[model samples]
Target: MGINKERSAWEKVNMARAQERPSAKQYIDRIFDNFMEFHGDRNFGDDPAIIGGIAQLDGRSVTVIAQQKGENTKDNIFRNFGCPHPEGYRKALRLMLQAEKFGRPVICFVDTQGAYCGIGAEERGQGEAIARNLVTMMNLKTPIISVVIGQGGSGGALALAVADEVWMLENSVYSILSPEGFASILWKDASRAQEAADIMKLTAEDLLSLKVIDRVIMEPNGGAHKNIDAMATILKDRFISTLEKLCSLEEDKLLMKRYEKFRKIGYYKE
Candidate 1:
């Protein structure tokens, strides 16, 4: 899609949350082959919101992990609106560790509003689950690539996002919290979400400028949903190129680079 330079951050946020936007399931179906879905955390029930499996990408085995959001009401309810519980994070961690064991790269598609804050999820240790993933991912021996395919909100998104290379779709967004939440916390009015988005620097381009993401994948003129075939092709190419580059690095170097990458993320003027 032709880059719309005039689009504001708030506009990009809306686009990222568009109901017609492509979900993680769609990306898996289009970009990979021989996907064998593995279910459950082996401690609790499987979480539909976090889908993890082994898939073949360009004839190479890779672990595919993503947060799945439903397009319709029925599906959304079934998937908990893509808000994962503690079990979902645990499931993702299991797959990542398994990928490392087998010497396969881990590819993550991040799209979530954050971990579920329900009492049950809290009782199950949601914070601990995400925290574990963050620390473990930092030290993983295999290459990790994370793509923000849609709305990436808070720690739920970050749990899957710690990677050697983090990419975001041109119209996607990644932020510490949702615009509505930011508005509520800052202005005591959720209606100022548009205003909050303006100043939040959460858009893909904005994040890239801030060095928050390594790259940006351009979508179709309107959006990825507008041209799935073209979008998928570009995404596939980008993934392959990135994977090839990361694969060339030694495991220790990869881990060190990943650690250093995140260590330099924030601004501190001397």
Candidate 2:
């Protein structure tokens, strides 16, 4: 409960990346039932980093997509530390379009360092994959709700984050880039990541104040890692309520509003 005081953006970033914090897999397990995972990008092999499939949330059918982070060193290597590759984005898009065909709402949980930047990834069209998703999701017929459950960074996260409603966990951080990356690029010193975090305004509270996110889901004291069950419960309720609201809107109206929601972002007046 000591988090009674406001936390700095850097502190929030650290908390979001804490080893004990709940990851997308844990949340999905608790919040959804009977998840059937689908693999492969159809064009390439499967990627463990970005997982997508069909699931039931509170008796309603939905398509769930999430970036999975590992809990241990071995698992991290297997999941690529949740940095998705081009194939991962392609797989997600395939599943999302499938969901749209069946009128199923899409739920995406974002927790990634960014798209994989390895030479292999670029060779496979990482940027093109993400850009394609951004374009397709803008007009998807069904509703979408993106939740930043942890460290949401760069275009990798944005590729799956276009939605009618975007939400962030209290301690999660979403930004154009990770603090270390920003520090290295701007100051030529990655060790000054703390300073970059402060300047980035990446915390959930900051984004909420800036109107970049629709809502901030409260995490248990000390962060979501402290109480996985409670955190999942809150997220489940929010998902149900939001899906219910979105289900009532006509397809055209939903798409129009989603367009407006994004178009209005970053607009400011002095």
> Candidates' lDDT values, in order?
0.91, 0.91
How many backbone clashes can be found in candidate 1? Answer: 2
Which tens-of-lDDT digit does each residue in 1-270 have in candidate 1? Answer: 445678898889988888899999998999999999999999988999999999999999999999999979999999999999999999999999999999999999999978899999999999999999999999999999999999999999999999988999999999999999999999999999999999999988888888989888888888899988888888889889889988998877787788778999442222
TM-score for all predictions? Answer: 0.96, 0.96
Off by over 4 Å in 2: 1-5, 265-270
The 10-residue segment with the lowest total lDDT in model 2: 261-270
Please give the distance, in angstroms, between residue 4's alpha carbon in candidate 1 and its true position after superposition.
2.4
Worst window of 10 by summed lDDT in candidate 1: 261-270
**Cα lDDT for residue 174, candidate 1:** 96
Which pairs clash inside model 2?
Answer: none
* Candidate 2 lDDT over residue span 16-35, tens digit each: 89878888999999999999
